[model samples]
Target: MALRGTNQEFGRPYNRRIVLETIRLEAPIARGDIARQVGLTVQTVSTIIRELELQGFVMGVREAPKGRGLPRTNLTLNPEGGFAIGLHVTPIGVSAALVNLAGKIVGTRHHPMARVSPEATFPVFQALIAEMQALRPKGRMLGIGVAMPGPSDVDSMSFVGPTTLEGWKGVPVRDRLAEAHVLPVFAGAELGAVALGERLYGVGREFRSFYYIYFGVGLGGAAVQDGTVQRGAHGNAGEIGHLPLVPGGDPCPCGNRGCLERYVSRDALDRRLKAVDPNATIETALTDHAGVVDAWIDEAAPVLRSAIATIENLYDPETIVIGGLASDALLERLLAATEPLMHSVAERSGRTTPRLTLSSDGQDAVLRGAAALAISGALSPRFGLLFAGEEERAERDPIMTGPSRKEVAA
Candidate 1:
């Protein structure tokens, strides 16, 4: 269970988010079953369901299963209830999608981008927003979510690499986007967004906590703990690439030596392939130069294995996933090369999920995840948000509004 609900009236706001999350995950479910799963009373579920129905966020369907005792009213999230715009900012291009409350992408548009400054991106974002609004004319406009490469706001490694997004440190990204679009905006690293996307719509559906390693131009990582992305003090908790693993190893763009990513990332693989054939590219190199690929994998797999052991021992997540921009075959090769992993606490028996696995969300996972950010931020319950101003609560965190001042009578 990703989230659970409370029976107390004081916790009603959080309960609503929990109920909604459960319904979205296991739709066509009876309210009684929802209550049982979320640890809430049936009466509380009914009350929340009533409020949701009144707001058009949920709808009930009466169905009679064959040989059942009675016809049941099962609830499902209303797909048309609301829509959020998901924007994925990459150095090469921007991918935009219109995602609904049901977490489905109903429309999409893409624009090529050579630069990534606010002046360049906001205009493109405006065009895409117009297209998405035209595509779906009636739903509530929830807000916008953006996924971008990170290590932002801190001097230690702020936009320091070619693969990582540059010139983004101290940009106030979320605030700038909100001002540009005049909508609520939430932004985070691509890996965090992908983790959230997986939690909502991908292989992460069953696991409450997991670590995601993203292999794009460079390697990045993120963790979902207690059903939310664990953003650290600088919103860079999962910057696994920069971890110092190998002694006196290759220098990294982040101004560090022996960084894990220098040995195990796409750039590392490309450099190896280029050493053999100057014109080799990742796409054709896998087939045209199998030996080169194997050699690189053999060298990199040990580092990845060590990282996996560290992750398992430290986070103890249910599983660790390999994801992001690489082709499945390449990912499969890395997964295969890293076999017979080093012993760790996760080596314990009775675990249902394998310690190492690959994400099944496909190449567009980041874009889809970017879309999930808005939904997750607005719908996921945050207790501190209960104290936010009414305007902030309703605008930035709709479902997190605290209980009304009026009493709930017996």
Candidate 2:
């Protein structure tokens, strides 16, 4: 379980991060407004802003004209302050992107992969990193964030499960990448990465609590509450794909019968489509084989609706975002077909945002999320680090003040 710290342990760093996030979310905002939003005194806000400005993390734009003697200066994030490299590795391919501090993709590249082993995948990662290196100098890149299928053991930095990322079990992905690039490396479950990316850059920015339903080759889910992704004790909190929705329907490699993914994932839809028209590709299924697409949607909708209802009842998130590699047309049809969504706690009145929504980033969600993971690590301050610093200080100065121990003893 994660531990919480007192204000004295984490006050300054936490406040600084909050200030930076406030500026990021409300750019061109005034210092006074930021101070109010973050609950920091104006003097402290000014000090943090000055430090951020000197470090190029934020820039002061022109002052807003008002009746005052001196206009309030607006502050915004410096897009060029830092860059993060994001990589999404999947069974089908690998995608790499360079993202700026402001959550914008500066450059992206995709490479198809026929193999999933470390030997074959590491070279592709190296090549992609080399390409992204051209976008910024070495030191400006905060770190590389990798998103891969889970049940990933975040502590081990390896993909677990017999079927997930075959041949990748026990691989020290973060350490290897860090050694090769001589920079920090962060690895996240694919769904968690997608949620993080959305939280930072997409519709998720508007909602502090939401569930992200990621539809890739398989179905996955991630939940964010109070702006923090709920990474369960083992970082496998959102592995919703294995939810046994249909008790005896189909067998999953995870040793579950009728797993949710078996009914709602891309592969599941593709199988239904291929059964209808042997030649149907994802594109063909949407365009040339509308009937097949409709049939798949019909089969997938109830399962999705039930899953959504379960997620809502459990998490009580403000919204549920459906995103991943699924096409917009397919997602629209699925949404439309799933109507009258199952009643849940989300059905309450005065709901500002829709209970169900499509992902704004679409196919690039995981890749962008990988980048956001790196950005979060580089920018966010954690309670553990603050406490550790306090411990180190205590070790250096064991007591407040005193005469020599021998003199006192004498």
Candidate 3:
């Protein structure tokens, strides 16, 4: 997902919008079937289908007959319903990509930060945004979504008091990014973003109630209930990183000792790596010490199992999705190591353990999730603009974007 391209805008026609949504949620269905699903007349569906075909938003291919009818044509979302930019900004580096509506990566960009301030790092973000903007079809640059390491407060659009970045505290990410690039901006907890992304595009579609455990620079989880990520009373419902896992192991930045993150987060992993090699980068260390990494996974199993059990006991979600900045390879290893450990525990308890699965998306799951938040927000006409006259507008909940904040919050 390199962000090295020219600035461009992609315009989406109104009819194409409905057609795209139909194909997105229910692909491989006939146009007439889509019309029936959306409750539009078959003639109207045909009209929209033609318009979408012209705009390259929908594609059709002949399929085998299901029964006595003639072979029908199945419709699908084109790989190019314009594209949205997704970014994950971390102390280690920034991962960026231009993702289409069908969830395909068109371009990518990466940059190492090594502990830089927001002001210093904004340039890299700007470059990536500019590149992504250029790559989008004319008028299609809906927005730029940047997912950073958190404890970020979504209500305030700022990083919470304690964070990995020095100057990120209380910095208004949505405002700064909007001003810097002159794009419609929305910001929130990176974990929330990742959870939302999964809810809309990934494992979330299968289960309404599930926990999204984000093991990134820090370990945080988000509780999704009824397709919406629960923000709790103060938008900190899932700060599992600060949860005490080891009472006397090590101090956490959130002023807690032996917190869950202090043991399972990348920062914790780096510290353990340093005891072996004084100078070790995360990517390199994980690559070189494969056996040691497996050992770490083994050590993390109980803690992770406990965390899942805690979430299950509390929320009793259908599934628990593990995802973060860790490589897909590492995720596979962790999944393999976790099964037997959890199964043994399940046997002892005389209960079946809930499903624990790794996120199928790339390392930048949170960033892609952020873009989902913005896209769902922008798609609704009611939330389009609070007032045509003023730029300042009301914020809407990500899941139910069309409703007023009061309604969504309630």
- Which candidate leads in lDDT? 1
Clashing pairs in 2: none
lDDT of 1 by residue, 114-194 (tens): 677767877887888788877766556667888987666656565666566676666777877777665568888887898
lDDT of candidates 1 onward, in order: 0.78, 0.78, 0.66
lDDT of 3 by residue, 1-410 (tens): 11111111111133334445557667888977766665556766677577556555567888867788778789886655445678777767776777766556677778877666777787877887877766653524445676666655442213432336666776777787878764566666677888988988786778788888987877889999977899777657788887787768677656657778776877777777878778875677567876667777878767776676777677767778988878877767766765644432223444353477788775757767877756654443333323322323322212111222222223
Q: Locate the minimum summed-lDDT window of 10 residues in model 1.
A: 401-410
- By TM-score rank, best first, the candidates go 2, 1, 3
Preferred candidate (lDDT higher): 2 or 3: 2
TM-score of each: 0.81, 0.82, 0.76
- For candidate 2, write residues 276-303 as lDDT tens digits: 7787778557788888777778888998
- Of the candidates shown, which would achieve the greatest TM-score relative to the real structure? 2
For model 2 the local lDDT of residue 81 reads: 71
- In model 3, the runs with Cα more than 4 Å from the true position are 1-19, 29-51, 65-74, 134-139, 153-163, 180-183, 203-205, 290-295, 335-354, 381-410
Candidate 1 clash total? 0
